[model samples]
Target: MIYLRRMDYTVIVYHLLFHLLLLTLGFSPAFCFFSSIKNTFKWGVQSVGNAVCSGVNCCDFHLNDNVEENLTKLLKDKLFGQHIAASLLVEALSSHRTHKSQKALGIGLHGWTGTGKNYVSEMIAESLYKQGMRSPLVHVFAGRASFPDGDEVKKYRKDLLTWIRGNVSDCGHTLFIFDECDKWPVGLIDVIKPFLDYHSVIEGVDYRNAIFLFLTNTGGSAIGQRMLDLHEEGVIRDKLKFEDFHDEISLSLFNEEGGFFKSDIIRGDGIDFHIPFLPLEERHVRKCAERQFELKGYSNPTGRMIEDVLKNMLYGPTSNPIFSMTGCKRVHSLVLSVIARLKLEL
Candidate 1:
């Protein structure tokens, strides 16, 4: 009789284990060992995801969502040239980030090298997230550095899509910047077309709530020509308006011979604006020198040093008029060098 009882107990234990296996595989997660544990784990993960997508607990970093206050902060000090572009940037970016809006904000920043294209991009991040390039929402991909020759482009496309989809799913308010896009692999831009599409939200990834900025010197020469044309006609450089170069820039960007030739990002109506960053002249370089000097902890300014800095920089166009080829990009280093020399001379 004791042997019979032992056999019965063994049967009971087997049934219990079988029941648990069914419960876990059929009703709960197949990966979990226990049914109750799986239910609770899945629920917790789903709840967190929901909170993030709904705009709660999305940013680990602090961000100022105010528009006008942010605008004031953007224009208060620093950033010398491109006032019109700055105003447009504040107006557009403020609305895009703060208000509930649809479609990704596609901004094409075009200009000569060192002409504040990258600077403006930095300022945009600073105003929005206060971390500038360090923002969790901002992703910068440079052409040569990112898409080097090889089968890397293939892998990069997969990673890029995954990153965008995953992040946009987590938080709809994401920002992507592609710098020096002129040198991007020939077929790479084509792969990004769908993500830039209006209202393209896949697998709970709402890409419409994101922002995309493309910076390049692809149309710099054309832009220079138009500015030179305006100057020749007696239009003050400061008076150069968006209307003067907007259409020309758009046309140039989409031209077949251009670096971004036939790019859907340029051709498509999805792009919100083509912001032209004008070339910096001597006066603008001086303004940049002043800012750079102040940044170096200089309480006073020197005229001789600033002029020499300007003279050291190379100019271009080699025609009726010329402008700073290096823009204010080299001014900071030049400013510091001149200051050190002057102090030693004194």
Candidate 2:
């Protein structure tokens, strides 16, 4: 009887161990873990492919096929010029100084927010960098928080100098794009004095080929108001009068808290040197739709229909040309998302 009991106990212990092993194998997260690894591998492969493409025939970057020839030439010339500075911060920067080398070219591009100011700045920076300007080509951003010295005026100057030092290259030819220029404290205009003072670097090197582009949205608010007023006066016909573009934005410089600010402004240099918001015309949009369909390995609403949908979203009822820099971006992103989805569907 004792031997039989011992045999039963041994059988029960073996059965329990076998069941535990089976449960471990069946419920293990090995499948999930492997799936994550596979996804990561695929992402890495795609990233590599994008980098190798180098802006040639890549819809991912959304580069314009009708890149302006004159703009390209102008950018190349500016990159090669000696001692260039550009901005609308102050006219003083552009005025002739007794000293020659200290002087640089100052250029200002002003429009209300949503006008694609930073977009243009990025294009310019990218163009220069591609032409071999140097690293750290575009500095981040700075503002009032950098100054806690005095009341509004003192603080503004301090903040501006701080921004200049932090952003301006003490070494190489650095092109600084001060985006959202209107938000910059009014007192900081004095800080631009040094870059404008074409005499000596307060330290050592003279800023040769270093141009500062000040993009602002506060050019003339009254003009926008007039457009609206005129429309109300029965001068304009359409319900959507071109008067919504006018509004004055005085962003507070007294920052107890720190964060990024954005704006919107409509942007085009007339028809002469215009950088159209949309890269492609109607025909190009159609072609893109077809290509998208082919890539998805199918076609529906055809490619042309898909193009019309995207076009309508970008420049139709949903579209507004007059916006601060920030506003423009929101629209751009929304349009792109819609197009991407439509591409998949087609």
Candidate 3:
């Protein structure tokens, strides 16, 4: 009995001495104990989540090879010159990461009429959805909305406000694609000023948790002119003043026109803006076109026709301008145009 009592007293003393030593070393006994327990729990949770997802959605992520390659290359841009659009997307999504706050990003995607900005934006949206992100995307069709019947500025602004409120009320974050931004009335633009600046109020909540992607066909020449007027003089941030360009519209002409015919300022206060252009590389264009055609039930087009299509659709370097409106319309009209005309089976 004396031996057992002595052993218990020794154990108690040892524990008390150990705790004192920890405290002397600037460690709290409770903190150490709780930290160890918390770490063990976290490790177990992570291990289980990884093990279960490894055979499911994790593997599905590996299926989109070409998309992976493209996105990987885009994300690797050091200067972010070639991947501005993708960078904005990453920023927008990062804002909504679990535990992150209600930040937002906006971008204005401007290019020529056939520059493929819409297609690129759609691809980015689909990629996010595939990655199991909860970000919601909406395609704003002005025709479908009762906005701006040529001059319905108030109605348009209201419609846009409603759309934004709907998204915020339904989800944590959203991607709003405002098409034909240049067509927005100046009055309506003023109405959306708060929203553009991430100061828009929805009910009692501040809507600073959305990404706005505005697409327009306005030229860079016009953008430069507008920037010169709006931005302070002699300010260079990466690119030059928006007005200078080597396109068919000369700088002098663009300045005289006050920018593009449909030009407007897209304030990206907390938003990312992208102006996606058609792919310059012939190989890239061919691959994209082939995939597009395949999806549209065109099994094959003759090598010559394919070349012609590329030339017309993408009139850049190493591409022929043979792709015209009539040709595109014809190809889109029939399901068996490839089998019948090209005599190639799908």
Q: Which candidate is the best by lDDT?
A: 1
> Which is better, 1 or 2, measured by TM-score?
1
RMSD of each: 14.2, 18.3, 15.9
Predict model 1's lDDT versus the native. Answer: 0.73
Worst 10 residues of 2 by lDDT: 267-276
The reply for model 1, stretches above 4 Å from the true place, is: 1-57, 256-259
**In candidate 2, how many Å is residue 12 off?**
61
Query: What are the runs in model 3 whose C-alpha is more than 4 Å off?
Result: 1-84, 95-102, 130-139, 143-148, 198-202, 220-284, 296-302, 311-340, 343-346
How well does candidate 1 match the true structure in TM-score terms?
0.78
Q: Provide the TM-score for each candidate, comma-separated.
A: 0.78, 0.42, 0.51
Please provide, for model 3 over 232-336, each residue's C-alpha lDDT reduced to its tens digit, 9 standing for 90 to 100: 455433353223332322332223332123223332233333443322234445555555467667657457656645555523212333222222223232333
Which residue pairs come into collision in candidate 1?
A: none
Lowest-sum lDDT 10-residue window in model 1: 1-10
**TM-score for candidate 3, residues paired by index:** 0.51
Candidate with top TM-score is: 1
Which regions of candidate 2 are displaced past 4 Å?
1-102, 131-134, 142-156, 159-163, 166-169, 220-328, 339-346
* Worst 10 contiguous positions by lDDT, candidate 3: 322-331
